[model samples]
Target chain A: MESVRKKRRKARVDETLCVACGCCVKVCPLGAIAVVNGLYARVDTARCVGCGKCAKECPASVIEVQEVEV
Target chain B: MKKTNQKHWYDYLWIASLLYLILGFFNILFAWLGILCFFIPLIISIVRGNKAYCNRYCGRGQLFSLIGGRFGLSRKRDVPRWMKSKAFRYGFLIFFFAMFFQMLWVTGLVFAGAADLRQVVTLLWTFKLPWHWAYHGTLIAPWMAQFAFGFYSVMLTSTVLGLITMILFKPRSWCVYCPMGTMTQLICKARHAGEKNSDKSDFVTEK
Candidate 1:
């Protein structure tokens, strides 16, 4: 039997749907989210502490926090 | 056309918050009530999307704007670019958390019998402030004292920021750098990242 460890969850954005509205950018306490190329929202996972503040502010309902198995 | 700003009813909430702080001198629990005001909204914003608490119910923000508008207390200057920078905001957040957790650690030590309650309370600058008149000669448990000290520490931090920003720039300028605002933003970011793509209408249901 193999045991799988669950890594910490992080917030990620669905780029295709992100309108680059910058709501998440303004709301992120850690400054982990930014609008890239003036088109979509991007998340800096390395900098993101997974506080989930931005997800609540996304008007498009495109951002989500996900769990990863490390 | 130049836009004129309008004041809303909730802006008076700051006055109410101020009253609450004043009342702390009579009954210290009012200070704890102030903590609950921030804590409840913070929890709601984290569990739900968007910072509804800040948008709908921040008494401090309202008070800042109210006094700024009525008394011309604000400098009417823009918040300096650097103060709004991510580095400054996040750096302050980190510092706040460090101090908060340090206090909690001290509380833990007190509970574990390794520290004295009186000494630990002194670690909080506001402990000896004029407001504690209500606290003396009262039968408060050690844990309650520790909690009160923690609340005082938090309030002192906000008051310092509020005073500096309210004086140097526009009123409510502290919102840009508030640690609680930053924490709420982090929670919103994480929630947005974790949720599945859906229509905006689902926003209400998602919560």
Candidate 2:
């Protein structure tokens, strides 16, 4: 049987909150973002790795975190 | 007025020198001291926040950030809420404990006598791991133990831990659970929660 693990904490970016500095884009290990209008970044959601690198890197602290058990 | 991320690109002066000399003294220096230096900046980063270490002090991480920026691969931080599971907790537990183990093992050796000493020495010259033989090379001899298998183990574990956090939380989660980050964090605990002039993490917020 294959092992399946569910994601517990959702990583989020408030577009209004995000400065679009591109730190998140540069820091994310997995390719989960597409820059919109050459300004803000949006996560593909499916590919995100929840490293929290984005959270830490976020200047706005707009990335609110909610931890759940999967 | 300099651009927000622009200053980050120009600061690489000691990037080479620091890692270069410090890596050489890995095993030669007292183990805890070596650990201390590796983490001082990291700790500074932690208490200081990820921006400090990720942007200012860390040589390797900076290079990655720079390249990622060029690729335009930089993305906003976002994910679903359900992803936060106990698995992240467990992974963090293991990652944190492992770091604790290293500090304890070293401290224990000093307090408990040769038993702890033997492990470090064994770690140094076990001549057991498949990669051990690499230490034999002229280029490899200087960094044989710590830089080779031991370093690999630490980096691999960190990388694995990092991967886990990235997959579930965000990239660079290791900075959060990172032992090195913890140390720096511990050191910088005294600052007000607001702006730290000494902090590079301030860049993300410094308007």
Best by TM-score: 1
Q: What are the per-residue Cα lDDT tens digits for candidate 1 across B74-97?
A: 775656667766688789889888
What is candidate 2's lDDT per residue for B71-131, written digit by digit as tens? Answer: 3333424333322223443465466667556745554544544432222222222233343
lDDT of each: 0.62, 0.43
Name the fnat for model 1: 0.00
DockQ, Cα level, model 2: 0.04
In terms of lDDT, the poorest run of 10 residues in model 1 chain A is: A17-26
CAPRI accuracy category, model 1? incorrect
Candidate 1 lDDT (Cα, whole model)? 0.62
Task: Please give the distance, in angstroms, between residue A23's alpha carbon in candidate 1 and its true position after superposition.
Answer: 14
Q: Which ten residues in a row have the lowest lDDT in candidate 2 chain B?
A: B116-125
| Interface C-alpha RMSD per candidate, 1 decimal | 12.3, 11.4
